[model samples]
Target: MDILQELRYRGLIHQLTDEEGLTKKLSEEPVVLYAGFDPTADSLHIGHLLPILCLKRFQMAGHLPVALVGGGTGLIGDPSGRSTERSLNTSDVVEEWTDKLRGQLSQFLDFESTVNPARMANNYSWLGELNVITFLRDIGKNFSVNYMLAKDSVDSRLSNGISFTEFSYMILQAYDFFRMNSDINCSLQVGGSDQWGNITAGLELIGKSTGNKAFGLTMPLVIKSDGTKFGKTAGGAVWLDAEKTSPYQFYQFWINTDDNDVVTFLKYFTFLTREQIAELEEQVKLSPEKREAQRVLARVMTELVHGEDAALSAIKISEVLFSGNVETLSGREIEEAFKDVPSTELSGNEEIGLVDLLIAVKAAPSKRQARQDIESGAVSLNGIKVSDVEKVLQSSDRMEGRYIVIRRGKRNYYLAKFV
Candidate 1:
């Protein structure tokens, strides 16, 4: 199937400037397309994956894809999706985050393709060096105040009061599209649905300035069936950076996908063929208890972002934790699997009685309860059931010589650290 047809089938297209014209252009030749990501944070979260993957989709179709980091606009902050004004970061911080975003984008796109390698561009290169006088006289003149204010991005922020810096963001973004079009002959811009206004402004700039035709397309905002944001968990935003959110955590996030949303998420996130997805959909209908679709989504996403080794490790951790055989997991896997569980740290390496260890880790409330729980076979140390109340846990008993996994019951887990 054609790229646009596939995207449509997957429900990726939200708003298109001219579907007929863009389809014709795409069919005739490889169209150069670009997507902009602002360095709002040091790492891109799961929310940013859709656009990054969209760029990859275009590249896989033999088209040139440019991943644009919004180093310039990031400094000013886009008022597209905010209820209030954004806190501005220093130029140095923005630059640092910009480099990090470029690195992350590099992972998803093919930079070494001999035929149509992906390209990276930072708007700061052009936007940073732009002369204010020239910008006002040349680029600023193309956007009238009325036109800028009418845009959804600017209009939505009128009541809350957007700063001149952010108010001028539309023009700045328009200038970005114009510059890329002039430099690389980029003819298409794709972004989330929220970027539709800013995108059209760029098309306007390109049309009026160079009189060249450029198209705009946007993907729908990802939302959950439960009326909550898609990429959020109880902990906070699901970050793509492993340091912020571990591979295990990332995998679990997708693994917990709602049955109602699993098929939709698979379509949005994975490159699995339509038939493969259809089979998974059939499983979802026949046996919701199996959660096969959720597993596939988790595996595909975890492997895509964190690599196969991390994905496999996460899967093993999940299996071991489920089977109550976490002793097979490494120290790192143990930490990741129970990272969210209650934990306690005891200073120095010393042999602590099993009853005391349970109390220290707060797995048991009192000494009597600890002993009763242990004697009743309700306690386990590192996955082995411990019925001996006098069992002493020493340095040798620690997982990786540091951690002691304590399980009070079937699912309740706690961690004790010897420092």
Candidate 2:
């Protein structure tokens, strides 16, 4: 299938300018397309998956893809989706985030290929050197106040208020396309649905400046069936950076996909063929209890973002926790698995009885409840059911010589650390 057909099947095409013309252009020769990512944070989150994967899709179709880091535009945040104006970050901070984002973008596209290799560009390279007089005369003259005011991005922020710095973001992004066209002969720009206005603005700039037709395409903004935004949990956004969100947590996020959303997400996130997805869909309908679709989705996403090794480790940790076999988990796996569980620290190799440890870890309300839990076989230490309330836990019992995993009933877990 052609790139457009593939994108349409995946539901990745939300808005497109000149669909026929773009199809013709892409068919003629390898067209160079670009997408911009603003450094709003030090790391891109799961929300960025669609666009980055879109770039990969284009590259796989023998087209040259340019990943544009919005170093210049990031200094003035895009007002596309925000109700209020954004606070500007320091230049140093934005620069640092830009570098990090660039690195993350690199992982998805092949820059080492001999043919149609991916390219990277920073708007700051040109935008920073642009003088105010030239910007106003050459670029700013193309956008009239009325035209800029009518855009959804600018119109939505009119009541809440938007600064001149942010108001001029469209012009900066337009300049990015214009510059890319001039330098690399880029003819297409892709982004999220929220960026439709900015993408079209860049197309206009290219047409008016160089008398060339540039195309724009946007992917739909991900939304869940529950009406909540995608990639968000109680803690916060699921980040691509392992430091911000661990591989295990990231895998679990996908594994817990809602039944109504799993099939749709598989198309959007995974590179699996249509046949493969159809089989998974059939599995979902036949046996929803198995959660086969959710598991496949989680494995594909985890391996794509993190490496295969990390994905395997995440799966192992998940299985160990699910089976209540914490004793087999390594120290690092224990930490990753129980990072958010109730935990306490003990000094040195201080030994304690099972009942006292449960009380200290607050797994039980009091010593009486603790002993009752231990006596009834409702409490376990390192996966072993402790019926004896007097069972002593020492340094030797610590997993990896640091952690003691305590389980109450079937699922409640607590951790104690020996420091």
Candidate 3:
């Protein structure tokens, strides 16, 4: 399939301006395209997956993909998909967050190609220095207040009283596109459907000022079958950062996908070919109880984000904890597996007994509850059953002289840190 055809087949194309023209251009030659991410947080959550993956597809197709960091526009939050005005982050904090997001984004897209290599850009370098007077005379003249208010982003927030800072965000973002079109000959912009207004604004602004007809395309906002937003767990956004969400937790998220959702997610998240995904879908129909599709989706996605070794460790750790095979795992593997679970620090110098540690870590409600858990064999340490109510802790039992992994039943996990 051609580029647009392939994207459409995967259900990646939500909206496109002049699909035929853009498709012809894409098929003819390598087109420079871009997608922007606002540095609202230190690490991107799983919600940012589509655009980044789309960027990878473009790069793999032998086109230049520019990953634009919204260092300037982030100062004014995009009000398109929100109910309230955002609390403005300090410039210093935004700068630090932008650097963090830039680092995280780099891992997914290939940046080391000799031909049509991926490019990194920050709007701050250009938008930061453009003087107000000159900017108004040159760029602002093209965008009227009425035209700006016509945008959904500005219209939605009218009752909420959006600040001029946010109201002007579209214009500034448009300027970024105009600059890229001039400097890099970027002709296409891709973003999520929520960004349709801003993407089209950029396309319009570039065409008017530079007289170049740029194109805009967007992917659907990922939604669940129940109409909930994607990338959410009861715990919160499914983050890419290991610290925010454990690798084990991440693995389990996809593993437990609703069988109906698994088929679609594989196409959306994985690099699996259509034939391969088709096979998985048929496999799912043959044995829905087997959970084969979820297993594949979970493994491939985990490997993409955390690496092969980490994926293996996550699965092994899950088996040890869930299958009641704790005795099969070493203390080191247990610690590595539970690093991101909720944790507490115990008094290191003091000789803290098992019951005290359980209560201290809040694994059990109280001393009495801790003893019952141990007696019933509902508690395990380093994958070994701890039936003794008064077992003494030892340094050798602690991995790397700092922590112990505690499992309460199949799912609850905690870390006892002795600092």
CA deviation > 4 Å runs, candidate 1: none
Candidate 1, residues 1-419, lDDT tens digits: the string is 48999999999999999899999999999889999999999999999999999999999998999999999999999999887899999999999999999999999999999999999999999999998999899999998899988888889998989899899988999999999999999999999999998999999999999899999999999989988888998999999999899999999999999999999999999999999999999999999999999999999999999999999999999998888887788888887888899989897558899988888888888999998998899988888898988887778888788888888889899998788
Q: How do the predictions measure up, each by TM-score? A: 0.98, 0.98, 0.91
Clash pairs, model 3 backbone: none
Give every collision pair in model 2. none
Per-residue accuracy of model 3 over 195-220 as CA lDDT, tens digit each? 88888888888888878978998999
Clashing pairs in 1: none
RMSD in Å for model 3: 2.5
Clashes of 2: 0
Residues 294-321, model 2: lDDT tens digits: 9999999999999999899999999988
lDDT of each: 0.92, 0.92, 0.86
What is the alpha-carbon lDDT of model 1 when measured against the actual structure? 0.92
Error of 3 at 4 (Å): 0.5
Model 1 quality (TM-score): 0.98
